[model samples]
Target: MSTVEVLASVDIVALRMAPEAQHLQVLLHRREREPHAGQWALPGVIVNGRTPDTSLEAAAERALREKTQVVPCYMEQVGTEGNAFRDPRGWSLSTYYLALLEPGQVVEGEQLAFFDLDSVLARKVLLPFDHNLLVELARERLAAKTVYSSLPLYLLAEKFTVLDALGAVQACLGQAVNNTSLRKRLERLRERGWVRDTGEKNQPRLGRPQQLYQHTPQGGRAFMFERSLLPEGV
Candidate 1:
């Protein structure tokens, strides 16, 4: 007669761009209670049936809102992990999500911080309770999505130039995308109304002005295509 595990939680890999789009960052928070209290961890919240989360997403949203006080521009459930040893108190399960914020999205809550994803992934920073593993898994999924979906677009600000979009994708994938292929994809996205050319260009101090673009009314969510900025699966 094993005891039924009561600990079920949702962890969010709330990702965003650093100022100037220098790096991709993930949101973390310091725990307040025992069992890894005071340790920086991915934003998480225990499932409380009384709060009556209408769905798993609702619970994930609550964790992001309550723990970090910021709503991501895009969010998706990545996967789940469960085991007896992950949590010290008892057997527990965690449903983790990948949430993306626009560039320069500010954190408005106390004790919430954003760390460079590279640092976390490289073990320069450590997290508690399988959180480090969760981040690694989420990044893998995010990178795959970046290859074939508009997932990286959520990392941009409301208005961005082609170069800006490339920077975002590069940050997520840790590789440079072809400027030509990216332009082609944007054209396709524009045709589908997922993106709109703002009919404006940003003047740079050094070079030519770059055209600006933004999401259209129907483009609040990430959209997928048969390919990315290249030929199918290139």
Candidate 2:
């Protein structure tokens, strides 16, 4: 055997709250070309070695911008999957990313459809190129992080109530998070000066006012806790 070429690609799992704010959603678009044409899949792009995309993260950003026009506030590498069978064209590898987004993160016309993660997790929808597995991986990674970190805050508005914070975690985790654990997490953030009470409350039609909290961490870093909110796969 002489040699073979293994191409590289980047896939993104951009997640946010659904339009109705009832569930977590992932961005997907129908493939325009063959090998999986017309099938809805995660936004992805082939890396061009001759270009300025010198890193997988850069290619990931380009894929995100070109496919969804969304610049997320937080994104992380999920993992790499490179095998002769993952793609039809030839041997290839893909480095997938998990992005946490908020409403209004879309800067232009968004052609990507938001699919409820619940549906995907339930196997109601099927994706090609082993993307379903990638989605599963991203889901677990996000849920694990949410258990002990403030990554879910990226899905929340700048100012939110304690309920909002907990809701964000539950939405991302796809499971009810322990309220006491989350409250203590917030308290820890406050102690670390990462978040603070804004001294304001939301005015509702009937319910009493609820205290507000604001994330104050300057950089885009999630404050970590000493323990996990839930055991892995819990």
**Considering every candidate listed, which one attains the maximal TM-score?**
1
How many clashes in each candidate? 0, 0
The most accurate candidate by lDDT is: 1
What local distance difference test score does each model get? Answer: 0.86, 0.83
Model 2 residue 93 lDDT score: 87
What's the residue-level lDDT of 191 in candidate 1? 93
What does candidate 2's lDDT look like per residue over 1-234, in tens digits?
113777778999988876547478888877888889889999999886665687888899889877888889799998998888888887888899999888545443344688888788777999888888898999999988887788888887778888888888898777787788888888989889988989999986788988899888758878888888885666
Q: After superposition, how far is residue 197 of candidate 2 from its true place, in Å?
A: 1.7
| Candidate 1 lDDT tens digits, 1-234 | 147755889999988989875579988999999799999999888886677688889999999878988988888899999998888888888999999987778876568888999999998998999999999999999888888887788888888888888888888888778988888878988999899988998898999999999976354567787865544555
Q: Model 1 reaches what TM-score against the true structure?
A: 0.93
Count residue pairs with overlapping backbones in model 2. Answer: 0
Clashing pairs in 2: none
